[model samples]
Target: MGRNTRKRRMPLATKVTAGAAALALGGGGLVWANFYASAHEDGGHNRTKSRGAQVATINCPDVGQKLTKVPRKARRGVAKELALLDRQITDAYTRLAETRQAQAGDANYVDNAILGPLKSKRTATLDRIGININRAGGTAPRDLGRFARCQGVPVDQPGDGDGGGQNQGGGQDDGSGQDNGGGQDNGGQAQNGPVADDFINIEDVQPNSRNLPNGLAANGDGGSTGSFTTECGTNENALRNSDNVIVAPGVSNGAQHQHDYVGNQANTAFASDEDLANGETTCRNQGDRSTYFWPVLRIQDGTQDIDQGRPGGGQDGNVGKIVAPTAAELRFVGNRTSDVVAMPRALRIITGDAKAFTNGLNNANTAWSCTGFEDRQVTDKYPICPEGSSVVRTSAFQSCWDGQNIDSANHRTHVDFVEADGTCSNGFQAIPQLQVRLVYDNIPAPRIENGQVVNPFAVDSFPEQLHKPITDHNDFINFFDEDLMNQMVECINSGQDCQ
Candidate 1:
């Protein structure tokens, strides 16, 4: 079947990251509402113990997402600065998490000790980014420093926010992504995330709650209707790393999170285009050497992966036993309204935002569901599947190509989701959509009782993202040989399923 559409992007300042709502602990009557509150955008909101809450995280504008048009010559430098921006956020969050008591004791502590310094660092970074662009003969983004100031978000336990945090009997994310994506008053061990409120029982989610992503429709009106499947082993060799060749090509630990890999064996922070073209493949079809990967999902049961002490693992707030997906299905299907075109070799597509927890749902494409409840999926809350059912993560990549560049400054402008009516917009061409489905059978369902959670499963994420399901994402780079690319286009155009 043709793949369903998923995800998009937006401006950074207006977004509110996920966090538990402020709830007064009964009798004690004090809890911290840590997500960025709507009313506190101008300056950080400080709630005293008597006010029933305190701030929990620092929210900042995502500078990288705003640079959609950097010159190609300056992309590498801009990307590095963007990665540094991310690093600055991580450091500030580390401080925020470490100084909770200090935050409570002094109203100015967060703004002075954390957010203020963060703004200074960001200003310098943004200036460097602008310099990089200008030196490359491209106009630098204006007012880049305006995004520097960060806000301290507060969290509520259960019984906070709208709908009082999805019914505890089971939870519902609504998939609209309009509310605070499940709050986290108390972060998990290492103080990074996946608290009790992040999980919702699959049974409680209303069936078919997930709408068609961006209103993408199956082939209709001359659209290519066939499918192509690639047999890429599920990273059995444990090819995992914390670098993103597409986004942060030369920086080690660029992603600040570990990702499981399949398809291209030569993927790394330093892998050049030529290196990838000559790389070995894990796919059954040697003609297809595309790299496909996603964040490693880990079960927080006190065990740790090998990277537990490394940069992208325990050190970055991601802990737990790494759960390899039992099956990783990589499939490509035709567009919804036009005959598909062969994707240019080296085409890179990032379907979701790993920073969506703080960057907002505009680019959150991660879908969580159980095997039996395929019709019900969520963008924010993780699903607590019942026994006999396995967990599933699905990413449907962008299907429209700009027809000119293989990549863009921000890495997103080159491709886009189909319009609401199922057609590519702004002269973008329709290309085969890559859909990846990962299934895990060993993840034990988490138990939440009285607002406390037992073992929970979460995808590895940047330290500040809080490990929310919305931050889940996938990446792909096309390296198919010319003949194979042609065959794929032919197969889809001819309405024939091919392997």
Candidate 2:
């Protein structure tokens, strides 16, 4: 049969079920006759061709239901394996869909060549599941009808690049009395066509000069300076040009939605769990292979209409091309007296709850301020930049580690934030803290809808009901190498500013 017309057959399960039924109904003579016939007509030698035969209908027991009967001791392992297989199947389908979409003319060829191995692997996985179920004294499901079929569906489709803005060179004055240098105009908003003057000018946004509270600064007595610090990719320079700080290393524009990335260079949209575990990093110190990322903050120009249907932007009307901060504040904070150990590999951490943007700010660690106007600090709401000031976004992650688990059931229980005074709590060990600060230079003036001024910027996933601007939230993964982690420990314990 041709590739396009090929259909997967349920040969193995059907043959096995038939043989078992025959064995029960007749004697050894009938069993032998049936086996011989199957061997000649549809056996291992013709497996590939037979797969294109008609699918068989069988009632397989639900694997999930049978899993509950497994002994508690073996349940965890079985569940883990099942989950892994599930992910693999999903990934396979995603790959197949993308291949079909990209190679419509030759999709059948691609499917036969690429999907063939995937089907075999899936069959093997089903067999393994059966073994585990039988070993646990549970009734194994005979029907794998769901697993046998290929449901070609793309895992993620690229959203409309409608509001995407280009990086323009810095320091040009677009006649708005604001410095257009080192800033981006969403969809050519800076061009003096029919664009309105209500949009905020980058030159008008000044830096906050106030000496804000430095909660994340190291407080050690200068004597202990063994710990060193280094930066990864260029943050300030990239921000100046509106360039992407994070690139999806292996895939073409894999990030789908633009985001700022730190640490691992291999972090892309196609990065698998294992890839992240073993991926190389962009950090100056090769030992720090962890990754930090969050969506890019866009600058809104009131002239263009906002598409609430976009992926990253919530259902709110806030629109315009997002931009990165002018300056990124990087720091490590932890116990002032004790040395911090290297973070465990694959230690995922998140800070500044995104959902908290709508609710009141309960995260005491969340901080916000305006550039060139540091005296004005606000939490939960976007800092209203004065005529000569810009907005600064800041977030700090938990610094205390359980000293064992890299991750936990909740993705948070394994790690906890330092005490208000920067001390470890609940017997958790102190780890070098990670603090991120982002500064936004260009913020459009608040919009006037129905004669009322409303904020135009909102965080990536805020609720549609809440249209307020969100300034901060962060994510991190610790994949530090062993030697580098030891070096960090020595430096922090030795009390050296190893920057």
Candidate 3:
């Protein structure tokens, strides 16, 4: 929904490798292994046992040399580190390739399944891993390196808008003291370069959405939503800003109006033409990266207004929203903030209390809210569930669409449409028309003050905000912002699905 948040202070020379595998505690096994080999004296460090004997020398392919003149001990250590770094990079590269291939393998797989959301996750993981790899002294593939050079990719900061930041005009200081020069400074110019997304692995996902058939009407976009447009180009005019629209705790409002000006205007200030176009590429590419690991929005049910506690007719539809655990709330309730805390534990804390989510928006104390809409009647005299409210019969809708819960092994049992007239079926046009809200990595955050992206580490403000993002269409046109760098920063800070 916003800009990238993956940029860090690390230089291009110092890289770090991270992946979905890394997202798992086990993935960090390598990081620990490397640290162990580099740490403490006993078994951790310098041993006469010598991996040197195990270290095989190889000729440098690019610079045809035997490459064995360094100190034996140092050489061995470097080799070991290089080998580890190579494996990490190669593994990540393989995963990224597989993800991209899988994305193209089957349109249905990409659309109905996890392509959009997982792609974003994969991208983020890749970016992290790249950072790690660089840190570990690895270099980008020569081809990528050359591309960055030719394109003059900007340095990792503003003004260095080139591919690698060697093109800052005369290296003039802007007085902000920020190093904003490097590559071509297209600060105001339009850039039509190659699209770069976060690294993500397709094979490491848990299948979190309903993988329904593509032809279903419920899954198709209604013309009313309009054709998708990129953040770049003349097509950006179609973007819808979905900021601060609240979902009543228990009622399913039909898909709200996707107006051009409905979202927070503060974010719009950073709208540079290049940022818009490039940001579209970043958003769509990252969105695609996220789908392999998570679910993307296939269809958006139009919105309906809540009439008191009762749902309006034609508007009373079943709606679903992807709810994620906020990092802040977890920090408050959880004993430890380490990644060692399993997903189940995090899920427990996030969903364990409704008050945490509802009240998180405001500093003021609000009532604990647990109101989900269901298609059944309840007796008023019965004691109400405090965390959640009972569904009222009058509040139900007539036609409804439901998402396929691909995460569930028994997806066939629950993923289908229902008639509003109280009938169970899988076909479209069922009486209980349902509205499904696909969870994209797009988190709803206030706009950045200078149109610049926020630091990933600075999201401490609202840790309870869940970042499971979904992309209705993994096309650049669907993104709301411009500024690929900014978009990347946003994704990183919010910890949502991004590449």
Candidate 4:
């Protein structure tokens, strides 16, 4: 449960899109669709077409990202509305998956039955969001309806993360990259995706190809150079859930994917700060009560986990056997140019983009690699580790604090990655940079059978994100006691590797 593996580089990045619409393949086998629309009139790329103009999943804009400065009074309401938007997309995608045959014959079936209704729902949600902001004495976001319309983009290739990557392996057994139009995998299951292309042999990745994103690492001068390590048991008790208290505080199954928790015990979507503060923790140091969690990694071997029939599991397109990490190492390091300050209590930070597949790579920070070949990391593709090497996921969090609120309207502006010179910009202050390393030694290496990847491993994700590696993310909520917080800051600033 311990390692010297440093959380160094952020992963290489690529963007994919999610759309909503049932896609089907005839002839008793899965056929790949080629047309796709991943971007929107709002931003990114334009929609593409194919022989049949097929789309794989939903592609509505992420409203949460747009509301960077929601008034404090309206935050709770806006968060609920955003969660509703997510549910609308999930529902639309599920409906699309259930009606592929009708889509094949009626060109307008997706528009009439799914996209149109989805837009209407989104429009209402957006309007409510605007009302919340306006009533709270804040200016409402203009053109909120622009994000209402979603596309069923069918990108040009098979197994691409075009929201239609619902590729069935050659066994028509796996869905390829985002086909959003109606990608089907083995047994013709829709939205259960992450086709063969989502993976790559770790050896194929170029040596030293991965770089530290946004200059996250420090220059090691005039800064808190020490470290603090916490002995949090590796989710040994099997504490797992799909709720995200940071993003969707009161909504159940807001993530629509399972997550592995290693620290705090009372971390459900409904738990309030009071509950978390009083919650039992798994960390050896009772003072360090922070909650550390990430999407559960699963092996896709035609099996299912306990939550298979639950909302965040199979019902949300996550189908497989869950694998707990062998080690969950949480380390706190110092800034590159300054002494560190204490992270405010109840501080929440989310690293990486769970919707990178559809929201683009501007905020993406996913790092994937093998145990020994950690130097070469991949941001966009899942690494197929060698025989003895285990799968390693590393996430280096933002070390700069805004010096104000612990939470933000978007849950991001409160923290920022360091500038190129490793110094915080504006009035942002240096805080302990949390570097997390999670090791998976039990997951079997994926195999290629009949030109398809068999038993591939994937991270739990929102259904439309298509289980792409770029979408892997982590969440944290600091519940450390004041003495412990001060201790962490002192240990980090004093150049000591204390536990």
Candidate 5:
């Protein structure tokens, strides 16, 4: 848990307080679960749609010795800011590697756990970088700002020669042969297109089926509400649960739902041209008139490691019991409710397979009886179970059942990845007052030198580690086009440059 230190530079007044501090507003506020709007609403999703099916290129910005010789016109103040930003980026990489290493031993790490920390660090770095850009008299890095509101920000610059996009390049190979740690500067101009065509309308999906409550069955207990305490605490405190835990609805059988939530209730998700595009969103529900802030709530599990995630006899057929702990396992465990913990349920067609949905979510899930964080057992006061025992995450993000990468034409309305930096404009400003959709993209398929796609599953397949694409959107249809389709095929055939 890294703490932020606001260094005392020149007089606070000396810091540029010009139009919009260029910092992403909304310091630390909780957003509802309709997290898909932020990215899709602004330029991120616009980029996806305007490209019209072009392969997404992942690029790292230039960070070589170029910094050693700061631009002659670059302000001295801006220079220092850039230097600080540089160190922060390096630190982010280190932290990301550490998180990955911690989970390296776990077989069930395929859910992009390692990337979680990386994303957080990336967001922070993006924020700092955006500030530097504004201080340097540069226009905002439009992409960064859009991401901050939704998916979070990105650090590296656009990829080299990939049409104004960042390339994931590390610096030169030393004599000893270590790749120096700077990104390359391609200096390519960002692609320009008709600005009017950048976005898709999300209103068409109003009363989206994803909003219905299937994970929390109707027969179950009603959902509960509460607040978390990441606000008044240190970094360490922010790492664990500081709120009340919620139990799964009684009708849920303490498991995740397998099929779509409300999609079948009515086919509101795919009614118009605007509904079929791509976009990005953070976890704020603008569509529903609810009071919930976050889409998911995760109560920490104190146990270090639990037995391989296999449940025993229970009302669901397994006898609930506890197990041991592992070093990688964090603290707290709990459940969720439709009113509070809302995530876009992957399935939309009900097809009367309720049993299939339930079983799929609870598969091999263990209980919270064995090891409890602080020896605390699961209770109504804290809907989460103790570590090593029967446990559930109180939020949608933490639930095993909440995650599925379904992007068929019907499922993927709009989706985009938002970086946390303030460079990109916020979706709120772009679309103002609308419901949004969000999704995460798994690592693209591996590739050959010629940039052809390789089988992701064949490359590496661990149920816990299986990767899939997660796209976010307000208007879902903005992402498709001949360019994008061709690029997607190219990316799958050759993962080299595609994200």
Candidate 6:
């Protein structure tokens, strides 16, 4: 049986709420609402408590056993390192509290500079502790306990035998001075301390560099310039899965956060490349069924904060949640002299690297700015929004395609951006450029934390740990309906401004 001939289970249509209303067919349609609240109240999804609800403690199981098993000669060094690690963990907690207190008024600053570095420092320390422990011929424990005391709890618990505070569930201390079980420990509540095998060691992967011929200047022919816009409803089933076939597809544990998807109603973590190519679409024009996705931007909202502290922290907080943007602005920019060719089916393109968040640079296409303050562009770092303004994330994909290869080995080599002269490079065909602008409605009333105003808006990545708010990444799959795509091509080639 052929692939399309086989009967396939149709994916369920996503349930929409005030946050994600039906896609309005028009230019710049906006939908603003409390996405978190709407999902919890109307979407039947259970929301987790903010990290503040969880208590922090330092408890490692089998420490005694592991210590005893170590060789006598190396025991002393291991013991010394372990003690140092304990102190370092405590210090990390102290620093975190102090930073939070200092930057409570500026949540964006806290996440961008203060919290992320602190988490990385703690992770490095943990990695050292694990190395020393392993060197002593002992295996390290998985749950090392929280690194700091919970709010309202004393830093030093007097009655607690292990020196750590009471566990979230109020479980009795397990002789080891750590609560063995009870209330769920919010992953973001404590730092995991980096392990030796942590995934951070992987280097940023880039597409093979290609030298292409430059195409004609954008308006060299003096043809009038034109553009078109497509608006689609955001999917609420935003999930973080390791199933990326574009970058590091062989690695199943890619860390990610919630992604807001448009176009194919069935687009999801489990959706395969073939599925997207063949799936039904939710776009206004039935023929324009290409899948578009990007990380969902979320606001702190006071009730819950962003977490990206744990090793798998990417999936820790706000997993399976969706924060719909006011509207997804899809505009095509191209030469007025030439009509754009319909995007080939199953063509995969990735703009901005998610892993680049750690280094804070490398990807140049990612851009951030305040909605009204477009002149001020921010990269890698988030800009503070004035009382009246909101945060905006803008991503532009490469517009030149090889016209032959649907995909490249690096997932980007097949595509290139138009030159300053507006011509395709290396014989690559110039297509209508797709630019996405996502606007986040700032919290009407900023939450007061420690007597300071905390901006609620945050990018979907690990804000507290990664620190790179500009790691704004986006993905696109062209499964456009043949006729609609042709219309878009006609509009662009004819130099007609289209809606």
Q: Candidate 5: global Cα-lDDT?
A: 0.20
Query: Candidate 6: deviation at residue 495, Å?
Result: 1.1
For each candidate in turn, the TM-score is 0.86, 0.50, 0.17, 0.87, 0.17, 0.52
What Cα-based lDDT does every candidate model obtain? 0.73, 0.42, 0.19, 0.74, 0.20, 0.44
Instruction: Write the residue-wise lDDT of candidate 4 on 103-134 in tens digits.
Output: 87888888899999999999999999999999
Residue 123 of model 5 has an lDDT of 62
lDDT of 2 at 224: 31
Which regions of candidate 6 fall more than 4 Å away from where they truly are?
1-224, 236-245, 248-255, 301-322, 336-339, 442-456, 462-465
Worst ten in a row by lDDT for model 2: 24-33
Where model 3 places Cα greater than 4 Å from the true spot, the runs are 1-199, 202-210, 213-235, 238-416, 419-466, 470-499
- Model 2: lDDT of residue 370: 62
lDDT of 1 by residue, 364-475 (tens): 6658889989888776778899999999888788888989888776677788887756678788898988888889998889887445466878888887777777778899
Each prediction's RMSD to truth: 6.4, 21.5, 27.7, 5.8, 25.8, 19.8
| lDDT of model 1, residue 479 | 97
Q: Give candidate 4 misplaced runs (Cα > 4 Å).
A: 1-29, 33-52, 155-190, 212-216, 219-222
**lDDT tens digits, residue span 1-499, model 2:** 0000111111111211111001100110111001100112211111112222111111111133223244433444454444444334434433432343343445354346445555666667667766766786666556643453332211111112321111111223446664333112233221111112122333333443221233345444532334456566634333211111121222332222345676666565456557876776667777777777765555544443233344323222224565655555555644665667777777767654332211222222344566665544444234555666666766666667788876542244567655545566678887877777776766654543331124445343322112223224576777767887677667677665565
What residue runs in model 5 are displaced by over 4 Å at the alpha carbon? 1-175, 178-409, 412-499
User: For residues 1-499, could you state the per-residue lDDT of candidate 6 as single tens digits?
Assistant: 0001111111001111111101111111111101111111111111222322221221111122122234434434544443333334344434443443344445354344534554465556556556765776667545433331112111122222321222221223446543322111222221211101111101121122111112212434543356667866545444334234343333332233555677776655455667776777767767767778776655443244233343222333332123577656877666634556778877877776553322212332455665566644444335555667766677777777889977653355577766555656578787767787877663342332221223334455532222234356788878876777777778877777676
Q: Model 5, residue 365: what's the lDDT? A: 11
Report the alpha-carbon TM-score of model 6 versus the true structure: 0.52
Number of colliding residue pairs in each model: 15, 31, 117, 52, 136, 13
| Residue 150 displacement (Å), model 6 | 33
